[model samples]
Target: MNRIELATLIFDRLVSEKEKLKTEFQNSDSGIGYFFLDDLLPNDIALQIHDAFPKTEQMVLKKSLREDKYVAAQMNLYNPLLEEIIYAFQDKRIVEVIGEICNIENPIPDDNLYAGGISMMGKKQFLNPHLDNSHDKDRNLWRVLNLLYYVTPNWEETNGGNLELWPNGLKNKQITIHSKFNRLAVMETHNNALHSVSPVTYNGYRRCVSNYYFSKSPLNDSDRFHVTSFRGRPENKLSDLILQLDTFLRMTLRKIFKKGIKENPHVYKKEKP
Candidate 1:
């Protein structure tokens, strides 16, 4: 089957296993929830999406304070079938199903796709541990969940580029989530769901399709506003101190300026009046 056929099949399966996947995600102790649909799409189909992806450029490469890695081209890039898959998740039925599993009500996706895009981690690229921005670009809705669809073929554990969840913080340890090909990992993103991507060691790249779902109200009352904060790994003490100061300085500016130095241009550019 092709990309369309494969995506349709996976969508159907997710709908079918909605209840079970929800239970597993909710019951997990790490304050994170995810499930894998193996061979979700054939290798050829997944590769096609990879091949169809446009080239890397300035507009998409989102660099971190550490300057090691960054996310690229987010807003449902121009591929026909990929766009279809993205919007399909927006269907009322599909949204409700995901909301049910997540135990949230009436979830709405962000109109401005912030921090959702294809992430490319090249050799030596690294993403410091951080919590995603608490709200969407406009601060209208609370960021409730993150949806990541990885399509990097033959990506292995040794490759060193994996999603790490630091539920307990850097002192305790982290749960490394593999960025396996054709695997979809959906997790709740909040103040406590601290996470990051380990540095990429391989010569090739690890590419992923990212999307996020937000709601009018936060999943928990304790949720509060924050930026995509970051910190170095446990071993990188000096890097950790610098990153901490970086977050503090930026956050302080936001506290006084209310909107920061300027509106972040990383989001989709809306038409001017």
Candidate 2:
């Protein structure tokens, strides 16, 4: 289906249960608000998106102490359906509906897709707990919400690669939201919203379409500008200390260089040809 058709399908589904989603997000635990919905689209359509994903070689491999995953933001390089579905959540109606549910005002979707797009994880790939960057690509608007849509078929909680929200910091157990097929998860992003993805154990890929909504105001009054900070899991003390130092160094650099020393190359530069 085209972008409009796909967006309409998702919008209708969310509209049908807006009140339930609004209530759930407002009352979420850990001081970080969130809500998820399964069967976000027709099963067949979601399956098509999974099938259309590009091969591993075609995507950018982001592997380090922080995380290991494959991501693609240059949408034109992949199947059109993948791009369509990625932006479907960015549709104005869908964005407004999600904003209303989360009680956010005047939230704007990022066209540059700053750190937002398609991501896939294979066996043993994991993302350590971290807070996303606080602002848009230019460090202008505050990032207020994160939208993730999972399309990997037959994916189960046992398969791993599920989203882990560390609402109470890394010392406590996380709230795991399985990256189940046809599921859409929305989470509020702020100073305290620490989250990560469990390592994938199954032999197959767990795919997701991601987007972020920005606003002129911070989610919390105390929110401050910071880079994407990483941390070790609850049991890894040494690693956690090391990551803390790493964040300190990066934060220092940003203070010296408002935009950092180098440009982040993860944005989508739509091809003009």
Candidate lDDT scores, in order, read 0.73, 0.93
> Residues 88-174, candidate 1, lDDT per residue (tens digit)?
555666567778877778888655567675566778887888888888877778888888777888999789788888877899889
Give the 10-residue window scoring lowest on summed lDDT in candidate 1: 69-78
The runs of at least 3 residues in candidate 2 whose Cα sits more than 4 Å from the true structure, single-residue gaps closed, are none
* Candidate 2 local lDDT, 1-273, one digit each (tens): 988899999999999999999889988944789999999998989999999999999999999888999999999888999889888888999999999999999999998989999999999999999999999989989999999999998898999999999888877888999999999999999999999999999999999999999999999999999999999888878888999899999999999999989889899997677
Q: TM per model? A: 0.88, 0.98
Winning candidate number (TM-score): 2
Candidate No. with top lDDT: 2
